[model samples]
Target: MCLRGKQRAGRVQSRVHVDTVDPLSAVSDGVYRLDREWRFTYVNAAAAALLARRVEDMVGQRALDCFPEVAGTVIEAEYRAVFADGRDRVFTYFHAPQGRWFEIRAFADPDGLTAFIRDVDDHHRSDQRRADRVAQLTAVLEALPQATVLLDGDGRIVSANRRWTETGEVIRDAGLRPGVIGDSYLEVLSQHLTAEDRRIIGAGIGGLVTGGPRAADPPFVHDYAHAMGSQRAYFRLQAARVEPSGQVVVTHTDITERVRDQQALAWRAAHDDLTELPNRARLLELVGEALGRDPGRGALLLLGLDGFKAVNDSLGHEVGDELLRQVGARLREQVRPCDVVGRLGGDQFLVLARGCDAAEAAALAFRLRTALTRPFCAEGIPVPLTASIGVAAAQPGGDGVHQLLSDADTAAAAAKGAGRDQVHVFSPGLREAARWRLEVANRLRDGAVDELVVHYQPLVRVDTGEPEGVEALLRWQHPERGLLSPAAFLSVAEETGQLIPITRWLLGETTRQAAEWAAGGLPLRMSVNISARHFSAETLVHDVRVALHDSGLAPENLVLELTETSVAEDPTRAEDQLSLLQNSGVVVAIDDFGTGWSSLAQLLALPIGTLKIDRSLLTAAARLAAGGSGSVLTAIVSLARTIGIRSVAEGVETPAHLQMVREAGCELAQGYLLARPMPAADVPRWASRVRAAGGDSCALALRGRAH
Candidate 1:
C-alpha cells in the first residue's frame, strides 16, 4: 500500500511539473489544492488571471469567493458533487470578474480534493469561428447559379439549390417545391422516373460518388437540361454518395443564358444585316442541307446580276440601294413559300427548293430571269436588270453543301457565259473547269506571269484594202491549260477588275511595238480594247498618257476600242471619258456596235472618231438571208456615213462577203479575208500582203461611194 501511494504521488508530481513548466500554462487554467472544509484553496497564475486577483491573496480564500456571482450556483455544484456524491466532478464555470470561461475538475480524498482547471476560452472561440465559416460557405452554396440536387441512399433526391427550384417553375407552370429534392432524379428531369439521365445519375451516385458516374456515388457535377421547343436550359449538378452516411449533397449552376447567347451569335454570324437574308455562309449551309437530302427531291440555284454594275454606276448607290431592295422583293415574290431565297453576298443570290426536280428548278430560274429583265423605275430612271441563274439538281450521292454550292456557282458562271439572263445546269466537269478558272484567274492577275500575250488583227482600207491599224487582242498562253482564247478567260478578267491592268499593259505594249514600227518607217496605228472597268478606273487617263510617253508613239496613232455595252454603260460618263482621250490626242473607236440599246443617235452624240460594226451583223451581210437583211446593212452604213464616222466591217471572211461589204459602202474591213490576228514579227510580212492587196490607197470616206 505504501509503495502504490508513493507511485501515485510521483505521477501527481510529474503531471504538476508538466502543467506548470509548459509554456502554454500562462494561457491555461490552474491546479488548486482544496481544504477539507472546501473554504480556502491554492491558486496558479492562470487561476488568478481568470479570477482577476493575485495568487498570494487568492490562496486561503474559499473557491466561491473569487467567483461570487457564478460560484453561488456553478461553483457550488462542483463542490457538492465531489463532497456529497463522494465522486470526482468536472464542469464549465464562467467567472464574471475576468469575464473568462474555464473547466474545473474536482476529486475527493481524506485531506480534501485537488482540482485542475482549464481556461478553454480560445478553444470555444475557435470552435465558434469554424462554425461561422461553415455557415458562410453554406449560404454561398445556397446562392450559387446552377441548379443542384442531393440524393439519399435510395436514389431519391434529398435537396436542391434555389436556382433548381426556380428553373423548375420556368420550365413548368408550377414551382418544383422544396420536397422535389426527395423525388427520384428521373422524375425531376422527365415525366418518367426511369429516364437515362436518372440511371446515369444514380449509377454516378454508386461510384466515386463525389466525382464520377457509378452506383451509390456522387459525381462532381450533374450537368443536364430539358428542352422546350427550340430552347434548352442546362445546369451543373453534383452529388456525393457518402455511403453509410446515406445522404448525397448536390450542387447546381445554370448555363441557359450563355447557351442562348452562343446560339444568337452563331445565327447572327451567318445572316445579312441589311435584308435579314441568309448570307453567303448560311446560303452555303442551305446548299449543303439540300445536297444531303434525297437528290431527286431538292434543287439549288445560284443567281448573279448581269450588267448591274452599269445601273449602279449611272444612277448612284442610293438608287442602286433601292434597286436592290426591289430586287429582293421580286425574288421573294418569285420563290415558293417553302423555298429559301438568300443573298450570297453582293449582287449574288441563291435559291433552294425542296420537292423540285431539275426541270422545275430551271423553270423557276427562268421565271426570275424574266421578272428581272423587266425595267424598274428608281429615282425616275428606267433601270433594266437581269440575272444569270445556275441550276443544280441534287444528285443521289454523298455530297456536302459547300460542294453543291460550288457546283451551282460553276453552273451560274456557265450561264453567264452562255449569255446573261440564261440558266445552265451543273455537270461534273464544271467543277474541274471552275477549279481551272481559279488557277487561270490567279495567273491573269499576275499580268500573264504564266505567259499572257497579245496578237494584233489588222484593219485595212476598203476598196484598196490598205493597212489602216491593228486591234490588239489578248491571248492566254497558260502553261498547263494550253493556249486559251479571250472568250475562255476575258470575262474573268473583267469581272475581277483585272482588265484595267491588262488593258494598260496592252496599250503600252502595243504603243511600244507600233512606235518601233514607226521608227522602222512602218507608221502603222494600233487599237486597244478598253473594258468598262478600265474606263471607270481613276488611272485611265494617266495610263493613256503614260503609254504614249513611254512608247514615244503618237497619241493619234493609238486608238482605244470601246465596246457598245461599255460605251452605253454610262453614256454621259462614256462621253466624258472619250472627251478626255480626244483632248489628249488619243482617238476613240466604238466597238461591237448596234447590239446595245444606244442607237445611232446616241452613238453620234459621243465624241468618238471611229465605229466597228458587229461581226454578227457583218456575218448577216455575208449571208444575205434575204434582200431586206441586206437593206439593214445599207441603213447602218448610210447612218455611219451621215454621222461622218469611219466604219470598219468586222468578220470579212469570204471574198463574196468582202465584195458584198465593199458594195454596201463599208469604209474598211478586218478579218481573215485580209489577215488573222498575228504576232509582231509576222506583221511586217503581213504588211507586205496588205501592200500587195493595195490597202495603202483604199480611200475611206463616209460618202455614197458604192452602195
Candidate 2:
C-alpha cells in the first residue's frame, strides 16, 4: 500500500491506496493506519466498530478532524511521537463521545503508522474502582487520631498518615529512623529498639504481614515509653492484619496523660493527705514486704498517743491536726534509715523495724516514747504529748502482717492500761487477752446484749430503814460461763463501739422495769449508769427520751448516773445533753463520786440531784472513824446537803459502816450489810418481806449489833 499526505488548512492529511482485500481488515481488534501527515489512511471493520465511525468517511480524514476532541491531547501526542521516532507506542484512551475505554498500540513504519485498538471498558472500570478505594483508605487514615501506617505483605511501609509522619519526625532525634514509603517497617523499628523489643515487634508484625500461624489471632498490641527531648511519652502500638490482602494496619496511640494520671492516683492512694506519710494500707503493704524478707527477724512498734482525745477536745481540731503532723515528723526523725514509719490513722502510728529482736524492739520503743515526750508546738501553743508504744518482735514461724499488727496493738493496749507513757513488749498472755476481747466485742456486736439481765440493789432511807429506790446493775447470763459481771466486758464494749447500743438497750429495759414496779405499787426510783461513749455519739438525750416515752415511766422517777470520767471525756457534749435532760425532769447523779479525778468545782457545775459515795471512800471513812477521825466522809455529806443534793452511801457492809454513814448525815444507804443485789423478779418478794417485818430492814440487821 502507498500513502501520501497533503496539507490543508494548516493540518496534515493523508491518502492511501490499498488492495481489494486488505489484510488489516480481517483483524478482530479494531485496526487503523495513520500516515506521516497524521491522517487516517485506512480503517478496518473492528476499528469502525470501536470508533463508532464509517471507514469510508474516516479514510481521507485527519486523525484530529475525525476525533476532534483528541486535539492537543495525549492521543495526538502519542501518534506524533510514534511518527517522529518510528517506534511503537502503547496507551489506553477514553473515547468520550463513544463513552468507552480502549487500549491502543501504534507502530511506526517508514511511510506511515498502524494502530490496533480493543474495547477495555470493564477492565478500566474495575481498576478505577480499586484506585478509588485506595484514595478512600488514605483519607480514612489521614482522619484517624492515632498515628497510623499501612504495610504491604512484604512488611514494606506502603503508606503513612500525617500523624505518623509527624511522630516519626519527633522521634527521629531519639535514634529512630523516620518511616518512609517502601522502607521495611521492621527495619525502621530496629533502628531504635533494643534486641528484645526488636524481636517482639518483628515477630508480632511479621506474623500478621506474612500470614503466619498467629495471623488468625487477635491484633498484636504493645506498650512502650519514649523520651522525647526532656519529656517522656507513652504509646500503645496496635497491629491488625487487613484481611485477605495480608497487609497490616499499625497504629500508635499516645497515652502519656493517662499514665501520669494513673501514677498520681497510685501516689495519693498510698500516702496520707495530712501527714504525707504512708497510710494504713500502704504501711501494711510495706510491713508485709519486710516480713516477707525475714519473718523471724523483724519487729513492729505500734504507738498510741495517750490522752490525745483530751487534747483534741481541749484545743481545736485544727491544732490537733497540726499536732498530728508534728508527731508524724518526729516519728520520721526518730526512725532509723532502714526502718519505716507510717500513720495508722488518728493518734496511732506504726514503725516497721526489720532485723530487730525483742530486746532491740523494746529499746527502740523506749527511745520513741522518750522522743514523743518532748513537747510540740501546734498553732503557736505548746502541747505536751506522750505515746504508749507496744513492741512485737517477730517469732519463728510467726503469722503475717495482720497478726503482727494485732499483737503490737494488744501490747499497746496493755501499756495504756498500765498507764500512759509506758512501753510494753507483746507476750502470749496479751495475745490471749486480746483474743478474748475480740471474742467479747464480736459477741456483743452479734446481739449478745439480749443475753443480759438487770439486777437491782435496794437503796434505803437511812432514818426509816424503808426501801426507797434501787440501782440497776448489769449481769451477763453467759451461755458458756455463767453470770459475768460488768468488769468482765464493759471495757471491751466501750472500745468496740458496742457500748452505745448496750446503753440504749439498758435505757429501754430499765425504764420498762421501773414503770412496771410503780404499776405494781412498789414505786421505787430507778437508776441506770450511762457510758461516756454516749456523750461522744451525742445521742444520750434522744436515747433517754425514747426510753421514757416507750415505757410510760415518769422522768423524775428515773435517775441517770454518770462517772466523773465519762463527763470529763467530752464535757461540752455532756453539759448540753444533761441540761436538756434536767430540764425534762430527769434527775442526774454522779456515781462512785470519790473514785474519779473530778474537781469539786467541776462537780458543782453540773445539774446534780445526788452523790453516790463510792465504797472506797466509805470504807476509808469507817476505818478513820474507829480512830476518831471521820472528817472526810462527814464533809462530803455536809457538802452534798449544803447543795441540796441527797447523799447515798455505797458499800455499807457492816453495822459500823451503816452507823458511820448515818452519823455522817447521809440520806440513803445501800450495801451487802442490808441486802445483796437481787433479780427483778426477786425485788418484789424482798420488798414484801421487808414490809411484812414492819418496814425496818436496816433495823432488823442492826438489832444484832444493838444486842
Candidate 3:
C-alpha cells in the first residue's frame, strides 16, 4: 500500500509506505503523513479521532485547512524547517481551536513528512503552575527585611535576597566564603562560627530539610555574636522548611540593640542610683551566692553612721548627701581587696568579707569605724562623723542570706546602744534581744496601746515633805510575760514610731486620773514625759489641749516633762512649743537634765518652770558629799533657786539623798523610799495618807530611814 500526495507542480508524490490494513492504526498516538504541499496524505484512526475528523475525509485535505490555528505559529515554522532540512523536530504546540496542548514529532522524508502527535495538556499546565510558584517565591524572598537564603533539599543555596548579598560581602572579609546560588549555606557558616554554633545550626536546619514524617516540626532559632571589626554584633538566626518542597528558608536578624537594652535594665535594677553600688536586692543575692559556696567562711559588716540624723537636721540635706558619698568612698577604700562594699541605703553601708571569722570581722569593723570617724569636709566645712559597726560571721546551718543580714543588723544595734564609734560582734544574747525588740515593735504597731497602763510616782516637796505632783510612768502588761517597765520597750517604741501615740495616750490617762484626784480633794499636778518626736510632730500643744479638755483638768495641774536631749534635738521648735504651754499655765520641766549633752545655757534659755536633776547626778553628789565636793549638785540647785525655777531631786532612794537635796534647797524629791510607782487606784488613798501623816512624807521617810 502507498500514501501519495499532489505536489505544487500538480504531479503525484509518494509520502509514505504503509501496509494494506495500516499498522499505525493500533498505536495510541495519532500518526499521519503530509506532502510537500503541506497536505495530509494519510491519517490513522488515532489521528482522525484526535483531529475530530474522519480519516477518509482528512486524508487528502491540507493541514492548514483542517487546523488553521497552527498557521503562522512555531508549529508551522518547525514543520517547514523539518521539511527544508530533512531533519526530525519535536515540539509542543497549543491548538487554540481545541483549547488543548499537543506534543508533535515530525520526521522529514524524501517525499513528504510523517508526524506523531500526543495530548500533553496536563503536563504543560502543571509545568506552568510550578514556574509561577517559583517566581512568586523569589519575589517574596527579595522583599524580606532580614538577610535570607533559600536552600534546596541538597543543602545548597537556591536563592537569596539583597540583604543576604550584602551580608555575604561582610562575611567574605572575615575569611569566609559567601553563600551564593549552588553553594552550601552550612559550609559558609562553618568558616567563622564557633564549633558549638555550627553544630547547633547544622542540626537545626538539617532536621527541617530531612524531617520527612515530622514535617510539622517547629522552626529552628538561635542567637549568636559575630565580630565585625573592633565591635561585636549579635544576630538571631531562624530557619523554616517550605512544606511539600523540602526546601529551607533561613533568616539572620540583628538583635544587638535588644540585648544591650536588656543588659542596661538589669544593671539599673541591681545597682543604686546615687552611689552606683549594689542595692539591697543585689546585696542579698551576693550574700546568698557566697553562702551557697561556703556558708561558714565569710562575714558581713553592717556599718551605720552615728549621729547622721543630727547632721541631716542641722546642716542641709545637700551637705548630708555629700557626707554620705564620702563615707561610702571611705568604706570602699578601707575594705580588703577581696571584700565587696555596697550601700544598704541612706547612711548605711555593708562590707562582704570572704573567708573571715568573728575575730577577723571585728578587726575589719574597727578599721572601718576608724576610717569613718575621720572628719569629712562638706561644702568647705569640716564635719565630724562616726559609725557603729556590726560584725556577723556567717554560720553553717543558718537560714542563709536574710538571716545573715538580720544578725549583722542586730549586732549594729547593739554597737549603737553601747556607744557611737564602736564595734560589736554578734552573739546569741543579741539574737534573743533582737527577737524581743521585734516582738515588741510588732505588738506596738498592732494596736498594743490598749495593753499599756499608767503608774504614778509622787513628787513631794523636799522642804515641806508634802506631795506637789505625780509623775506618770508607762508600764506594759504583756500577755505572755509579766508587767514590763518602760526601760524594756521605750527605746524600741521611739525607734519604731510608736512613741507619739503612747505619749498621747499617757497624757489623756494622766490628766483624767489627776482630775479624779483633784475631785477627791487631793489636787496633785500631773507630769507626763514627752518625746522629741512630739516637738517634730508640732501636735504637742494640740494633744495637750485635747487631753486637758476631755478630762476637765486645769492647765495649771498638768506638767510636761521632756528630757534635755529631746529638747536639744530641735531647740527652736521645743522652745516655741514650751513657751506656749508655759503661757497657758502648764508647767514645763526639763527631765534627765544632767544626763544629756545640752549646755546649761541652752537649758536656762528654755521656758522651764522646774528642773528634774538626773539620778546619776544625785548618786555622784551623794558619793562626793562627805568630801565637800558635791558642788555640782549644789550649784545646779542654787542656780535654779536664783532663777526662781523649782528643783526636783530624782532617785532619792536613801536618807542621805533626802538630806542632801534638803540642804541644797531642792524644792521637791521623789524616790522608792518615799513611795514607789503605784497604780492609779492607789494614788488618791496614798496622797490622803501622806497628807494625814503631817503632809511631810519626805521628812517621815527620813525619820524612819533606818527601817
Error of 1 at 528 (Å): 2.0
Off by over 4 Å in 3: 1-134, 174-177, 191-196, 309-325, 377-382, 628-630
lDDT of 2 by residue, 1-707 (tens): 23334434332333334435577766799988887877777778788877887666677678878788988877888988887788899999988887889999999887699999999999998879766765776798999999999888889988889998988888887655687999998887666555777888888887888796668479999877766667788878899997665678899899999989998999999999889889999989998888888879989999999999889888989999999999999988988999999898999998998898999999989889889888999877899999988999998898888999999999999999997899999999999888888889989989899899999999999988999989999999999989999998999999888889888999999999999999999999999999888887889999999999999999999999999878876677788899999999999998998888878778878888989999999878777777987468999899889989999999988898888888899999999988899999999999998898889989876774567
Position 120, candidate 3: lDDT: 87
lDDT of 3 by residue, 374-459 (tens): 78999998998888889999887887888889999999989999977889999989999999999999999999999999999999
Per-candidate TM-scores read 0.69, 0.67, 0.81
- lDDT comparing candidate 1 with the true structure: 0.73
TM-score result, candidate 3: 0.81
Regions more than 4 Å wrong, model 1: 1-150, 155-196, 206-218, 226-234, 240-246, 277-297, 305-341, 363-386, 446-450, 480-483, 621-631, 689-707
Best by TM-score: 3
- Score candidate 2 by TM-score against the native: 0.67
Name the weakest run of 10 consecutive residues (lDDT summed) in model 3: 9-18
> Clashing residue pairs, candidate 2?
30-47
User: Which 10-residue span in candidate 1 carries the lowest summed lDDT?
Assistant: 698-707
Pairs in steric clash, model 3: none
C-alpha root-mean-square deviation, each candidate:
11.1, 8.6, 5.7
User: What is the per-residue lDDT of model 1 for residues 569-635, given as tens digits with 9 covering 90 to 100?
Assistant: 6788778778998998898888888667777678789888888898888776656645554456767
As a TM-score, model 1 comes out at: 0.69
